[model samples]
Target: MTRVVGKRAARRAELFDQLVGLFLDEGFAHLTLDDVAARLRCSKSTLYTLAESKDDLVRAATVHFFRRAADEVEEALARVDSGAGDRVTAYLEAVGDQLAPASARFMEDLARMPGARGVYEQNTAIAAERVRTLIAEGVGAGEFRSVSAEFVADVVASTMVRIQQRDVARATGFDDAQAYRELAALVTRGIAR
Candidate 1:
């Protein structure tokens, strides 16, 4: 994973953002240095200016993408929504937004890559903890049912993982984003007092 610190980190982030969509369209395993360069409209030498190998490039890009995603989700949580429920829903939607454009193949590739999977797992866990905090706040405000926030938080996190599964999406005819919307609705209603 790229430390993403130091001079010209903004330039590095900009480059990573440009490549994220390409990687999501054609997973790391399928994309070669030539393919990346072609898609990026840059030369292999320019890519080497960022990373030494293809694998390193992918790892850094994945990490950088997820880091930006987490920041967005946190920003969503901090917004002054209509209510705590809305805030939570916005946060969940933000989570979905992170991978809104990722293809199923991209998801499968993520599972196959340990480093990428770690970034995904860590983000989900953070989302889960944030959900727990919101749930407790809602309950305290008498806006949500007085339920076990921790348990429900765990369920929300697990549901997030399940929503990303290809089989679940195929069986339900809901893409990851749709699955998240439905799940958010279910959770909001399920916990509503």
Candidate 2:
């Protein structure tokens, strides 16, 4: 029974990942449950096993996406054998890379969906806090100049929100991924010792 349950859980996770990939490659707004089922080559019942409704499914998928991205970002940071400042740059660059696969349509769809947008906003806030922690560590280790980590994190958070809202893209003609890369460079250079 335990083996059966484990296999079931594994299949669910795999299906969920496939759903997320489809949503990432193509926005979810235009896709109905039937469309999703058709794309995934699974029945609507299988999707229902993941979430109760289409909106819930989208929200769950968004959460999953961020969770995976966070893991990858940390993994990238772990591979960096440099000082705190370099780790900070690596963290942000990994974030950019994680977001690189998100198409404009997916972003637009996220903006239109309050549930998914909220998830994105929450993750952005979390990322800002992570940045704050990294900055504080750098400052404590004397790898970065003395600066108010909280203030810098607030700025980064605000920019992240703007990036999510497409304001940065509109103003600079840079996509979210590009904006993140630019942000990484700017912040690293600004805080470096």
Candidate 3:
């Protein structure tokens, strides 16, 4: 993880990190310029230095957090010391763990904001590809039963998106973490011989 500052000076990296935590704790969409300024102990102008408006700030922060979360999930997968099937479980578990901290408000904000949803959809695509690869690998190694890797991967990925749906999550009465845990069990059982 190169500093998330992204070309800005080291100070902006610090500010971004601080802002990310705040946004994660309190929903980004609900935050005001004054709220950000007060939280960061900076003036509204300083807040403007980072974003053009509250919506822009929310969009930027949403992008930044999703990018960081994707990177962290990749890192977590890399650190898993297991076969592909277990790695898949670890990957899903890590994703759930990563999202474990997000408040329902934060989740709702991400669901409603188009910019944030785009970031999330991109991340979901990446995860789907990763699952496809992992399934193919497991099949090649004779660990998993021969199956349609792409189909299974697509199912897994689609379930991931379904679990994240606000209404679905509410209807099922499962938070994102539990949804993922259940997904892991459902997938691994169905796929395992």
TM-score of each: 0.87, 0.97, 0.89
How many clashes in each structure? Answer: 0, 0, 0
* CA-lDDT, candidates in order: 0.81, 0.92, 0.80
Q: Between prediction 1 and prediction 2, which has the larger lDDT? A: 2
lDDT for each residue of candidate 2 in 113-136, tens digit (9 for 90 to 100): 999999999999999999999999
Worst 10 residues of 2 by lDDT: 84-93
- The ten-residue window of minimal lDDT in model 1 covers 1-10
For 54-121, candidate 1 gives per-residue lDDT tens digits of 87788778888788888887887677568878977887887787778888878888877877777777
Let me know the TM-score candidate 1 reaches against the reference structure. 0.87
RMSD of 1: 3.6
Which clashing pairs does model 3 show? none
| Cα deviation of 89, candidate 3, in Å | 0.4
Model 2, which residues run further than 4 Å from truth? none
- Candidate 3 TM-score to native: 0.89
Model 1 lDDT at residue 72: 80
